[model samples]
Target: MRNKLVEFKHVSFRYGDDQPWVLKDCSFCIYENEWVAIIGHNGSGKSTIAKLMNGLLFPQEGEIYINGQLVNDTSIWNIRKDVGMVFQNPDNQFVGTTVQDDVAFGMENRGFAREDMLKRIEQCLHAVGMEAYRLTEPHRLSGGQKQRVAIASVLAISPKILILDEATSMLDPKGRQEILSTVADVQQQHALSLITITHDLNEVTQSERVIVMNEGEVWNEATPRDIFKEKTALRKIGLDVPFVALLTDELREQHIQIDNEPLN
Candidate 1:
């Protein structure tokens, strides 16, 4: 069995004393080299979980562990080195004037040696297919290219877990596809554990596991095939079933047996 890379035990959180809980009794484990997608409606607390995992937010009532190291004040810095997050807005993440500079910024902050930083910058940029744009200014790149640079910046840090927090939401369809393909290649090449927080069902279909959240709680956890089977429940919670699943449901209503779940 794969070792657990991150874990949440009976986790609960709230903004303040008067605020209602944003996460309640949450428990789950993300294993090494696994690709998991977290899906939910706008206020369902998916992003909150990402923040908790990276130590941006702490749980009021439970514990969170990364590589068996508890997420606390003292360990947070160390934990963050293992978790790299790419947010929705690529523009917000860009700090360097050029592609190579942006990719090297994180390593520089950590005081990486000049030679090592140069090597990592080269490797990561190439890994994201952005090597040719090494000297390009951020303003000249497209949204997809910008996001890929953001991803390269994260990979340059060599984090064990990669969190894409609505990273593709702001892109057009072609841009979105490009980013996903780049992410897939990066994951395969590096054996990285990937956590994708997205509302796109097509993106969720690519993950090995699906986590559904509603009202700050985990509503369901299953494979894509099994999760899509509950079309009515999903619809009630403002989520849509995959198109292929809908077709299968219609065929079933006509008494046609689908021996295999098409999207599984």
Candidate 2:
């Protein structure tokens, strides 16, 4: 069995005492090198969970652990060293004047040896297929290209876990595909665990496991195929089913027999 990389035990949180709780006794585990997707409607507290995992925000109740260490003020930086996050907007992550420099920004902050930083820049850029854009300014790149650079920058950190918190929500279909393909290839090459937080149900079909959140609590956890099979249940929680699941339901209604379950 794979080691547990992240654990949330009875966690709960909110912005303040006056605000309502955002997460209510949420609990889950993400295993090493696994791809897990957290899906929920807006205000379901999915993004809040991501912030808590990396210590951007601490839970008002319960606990969060990363790589076997509890998340607190003192351990947050260390936790971040093992976890990389790419948020919804790729533009928000760009800091360098050029592509290569952008990839080096994190390493610079971490005090990577200059020689090692240069080498990692080349390797990460190539891994994300952004090598040819090495000299391009951040603003000049397309949305997809910018996200590729962001991924390259994160890869330079060599984190054990990567969190895509609505990473593709701002992109067009083509841009979304670009990021999805890039993430899959790099995850294999780097042996990194992936946590994708998204409301786009279609983007999550490839994950090894799916965690569905509703009203600030974990509603269900299952394999992607198993989760998609409950199209009616998923919709009742305000989540739409993927194309394949809907198609399967239609086929069955038409009396067309399918030999096996279909999940796209």
lDDT of 1 by residue, 71-190 (tens): 999999999999999999899998999999999999999889999999999999999988999999987998889999999999999999999999999998888878887897899899
Question: Which parts of model 1 are misplaced by more than 4 Å?
Answer: 248-264
Q: What value of lDDT does candidate 2 attain over all alpha carbons?
A: 0.91
Give the per-residue Cα lDDT of candidate 2 at 151: 85
| Tens-place lDDT digits, model 2, residues 179-224 | 8878988888999999989998988877889999999999999988
Q: What does candidate 2 score on TM?
A: 0.94
lDDT of each: 0.91, 0.91
Q: What TM-score would you give candidate 1 relative to the actual structure?
A: 0.94
Per-residue lDDT of 235 in model 1: 90
